[model samples]
Target: MKIRKKPPQEEFVSQAVRTGGDGQDAQEIAFIDNALFHADHAEDELFGEGSERIEVADWHFISPSCLEADGPPIKTKVLTPKQEKLLFLRYNYARRRIRQAQIRGAIRGTFESLMIWRQRAQDARDALVNANMALVPAMLRRVNCPNVELEELISEGNVALLRCVDRFDVSRGFRFSTYACRAIIKAFHRLASRRATYQKHFPAQYDPQMEKCDLGDRIHRQRWQDSIEWVRDMLTDNQAKLTLVEQTVLLERFAMAREGKGMTFEQIGPIIGLSPERTRQILRTTLRKVREAFDKDTAGPVQLAGA
Candidate 1:
């Protein structure tokens, strides 16, 4: 069986830069460029269709730098006269609206007009973002945060880029790239700090089993404390049918009070002037009544230490 080879891509020229080509190829390139130039001006018209021509310059395989690695930075490419003029227009548009918003801060109907100007400003800023995407990778390489992925750093840099556009002062004569780079670096640091704090609370290698055991222990301790509180309240209840001697015996026998040592019947019997057997009988009867009351008041029986 014979294998079929793939055909060449419709795009012949790879990039904006020129390379050695014959007169025929140059003519073809010029024709394609002219078509695109007209297509870009058409509104709501599909490319490669009636009254529309395809865009193929950006579709080709070309390094954004469009120059030698030893040459000037890629961000410098956006500093052309046309781009500068567009940026100036966008800046002035946003500036006029900002002043208007301030003047009409107390007015109710100023919002819609302010929003329109803001949208225009954002469109202009987005153009700047697209032109300066090369700067993001360069800055991320410089930061060298091993923990963060290149994609995450790029996303953070994009956010910082938007913020920089909002705050950039064109009158200062400083390049937008310089201001945006600083903001992007700060964003990277903030993200790293947040990740560090989160890791401190919950480490990367979390264990659900350990957490489950800790939860169980906490629940058990809570139940034990509730049981102790219930017994103490029962002993102190003046309306309960328990006699005075029985209350004293319960409090002393279970260490419910600070002075209690959970004394045996023999020890408590002499203090109460009763036989040890009689004291034990009263203690058992009082505990049985308390247990019954506790079961009735709560969902389940309390776990006595030695029932």
Candidate 2:
């Protein structure tokens, strides 16, 4: 597949050159575009559509280095002039709003619309963001590992920051720092997981065994009876080496789970003799096999786009 760059992404970067602060005024800062492209089309766990438009949804964080006049400048990219200005404006507003709320004793209300809306919520969240410069990075860096590269962590951080922005509710008596930290950690794990060669090792080729199976969707998941067959297909050599116990585990670990995401490593670790790492490797291997079978039967040229 041809890999091409997408439209520039927007991000912030700290540069080397220092601006002379005029008396009391602060120097304006510029933002950077640090997004890494994943595919030439809309790829998910696997690339889906679009021959030209690349998908950056899987791009990771490249955390930035903060030392001055020490080592060489970290490998970094900058955003366009327009995007930089917008980022500046966004952070400025976020900081100001958080500041006003703190100073004025303005406590927001709790999240109550979750019950009424059930599924669709327009005014879902209201919360205090990491307003002061003091709290923002501390909130975002909860998951940063010193062993990991800096720029990568920051890239993951941006995605986490956005997630926190979306899910935060100030009225809940929880600080934005607390909520944002968890989100950043989750985003970091997701980005880190992408480093695994899921695509390279497991390609879902077309199949015809089950007439109408579709793997690329959240909907149309196989029934328990059909799930048995699916799990069988997932085993190496198509169940030739799969034990009865292994099949049972797959049923509960993956097939029975909603959304087909399977049990987490911690959750599934005790059930099988293997550790979580081994379980993950096995699941990844099995999933690609099943997905390939399903795609051949249902998601191939036989189905319409978005079907």
Candidate 3:
């Protein structure tokens, strides 16, 4: 039997692992691109056609000219078999972390960021609706109408949604849903209060009373204002004196680092659209300012309340 010469092991392996960019080997590049594409979007339909007609912005993968009979496969890095497996695992883990971070971010932004303030705002909104509902009964009783219909109240609810949007203060840490309900109920109450029947019970308070109407109303107004004022005072009293940049950085870090975990200073900078080194510098400066502000201004004995 004629014996055919066998290529050396190193040569055979080198050919298999060939990497270069002298000319793009479209077929080889397509294979590599396909792996990464599927890893990113499992259901993605990929066309390995060269991008001569499609731009990168269109998310097309095109093989370069190198391997199209013009040159050897374009040189490029490829993971060793072990490295490829590691890359696959690491990418999946990182993607999961990103998703978890997003959920945490939504929770914090929606209700947890300003917890107490949001609660108060929501309470106020609910109170407004309750107070408005109370008005209808008061109106009916005053008019002595056992036949008062339910339609008006339902219509009033729709109006409440609008009033909530107009009056809701995001700065108050209350969701619009909470505050708008109050404004809506208040509208209903105002509408009902003008009725001649309401005068029976609320006449004195609702302005049917001739003499004490102004006094009663002013007092009520001040009391309502005071509740809001109290929240404002608390916010101001404990407020940290962070610069805009500092706040931006803090929020960025809070988003990147979640669940009691923290991001690298490098990670935060990119989030806030800054360089990683710049991010670190900002952190040092901002932390110093916050500590000093808390130190100099914190209430009795510098005790922390979720500080």
Candidate 4:
């Protein structure tokens, strides 16, 4: 019996799926069109060159501890200048190949080759990042920020390092560490400045149990109490021209002179020797007279204040 080997494209796809490619390789390949490829070439002619293939097998193994938030400082052999340059060249070259493949319009036939280049580019970038992951912890040692946690500073520094990896120019004749260190320091400074500004605006931490100022509520209650006192005085002075029966009815219905709940129309009706409907009519008339008097009394003070 003979075993038939799968084609290169099918094999590569299977390998990608096993290695957590998550369909992004296909999407990324599909995203590279002629317009973007031409735009990238026009903007930066450097991306057009550097097609030399670089071996990535040596840098493929990234330590799991390097990615852990609470893990100890990552200790990896720093890349020499030659190795650094090669990694950048490989990364950029792989990206260019994807665009070139798209331009050729043979994506289906060249899918395996495109995925290989994409994986190579990603591996090169990851190798560069892992090589310098130690810089974040080293920088944190120099920073004395009590407000920011070590984990948070590390996260910011890692982000800055990744951005530096993407933006650093090997042709500039400078070390990657030099560029990355400056970028990380700037990120830390920005984080500190933002924290300082936030603290300035909000000096204290939030506390759900903290007592809030109730000045508005107190003022509202005081105004309501003053109105009640004025109404009581008006009834005492008979200023609204209330009959004796009307006065008694108002007092009982509202519980103005008592400590208990107010009486209902039925209860007030029996007390005043009238039907419930008649008692309601009398209450309504008394309220209208009180409201008119109160409004008249407040109008002068309001107009005077405005004048």
Q: Pick the candidate with the highest TM-score.
A: 4
For model 4, where is the 10-residue window of minimal lDDT?
298-307
Task: Give the CA lDDT, 0 to 100, for residue 109 in model 2.
Answer: 21
| Model 2: CA > 4 A from native | 1-149, 198-307
Tens-digit lDDT track of model 2 for 1-307: 9977433321100111111111211123212211212223212211124222221122232233322224234333333333322332333333332323323331222112212221111111111122212232443444544434556756567656755554444345445556666666676676656644453465564567756655744344334445544444445455334455455456557545345565666677687767878776776655554556557555222221110
Task: Go through the candidates in order and give each one's C-alpha lDDT.
Answer: 0.58, 0.41, 0.41, 0.68
lDDT of 3 at 191: 52
- lDDT of candidate 2? 0.41
Total clashing pairs in model 4: 0
Q: Identify the leading candidate in terms of lDDT.
A: 4
- Model 1: lowest-lDDT 10 consecutive positions: 14-23
Candidate 1 TM-score to native: 0.39
lDDT of 3 by residue, 249-298 (tens): 65455432234545667777766788988887887776565556546654
Residue-pair clashes, model 3: 11
Model 3 global lDDT (CA atoms, 0 to 1) = 0.41
How well is each residue in 1-307 modelled by candidate 4, as lDDT tens digits?
9999988977765545433345444334422122333454532432335533334333343354644556566555777787887677666666667655545443355666766767877888887887777787766665667677667787898899988887777777789898888888889888888888989999998987576888898987676566657768888887889998888877887677887777888888888899999998988888777777767786312110100
Candidate 4 wrongly placed segments (more than 4 Å): 1-75, 103-106, 211-307
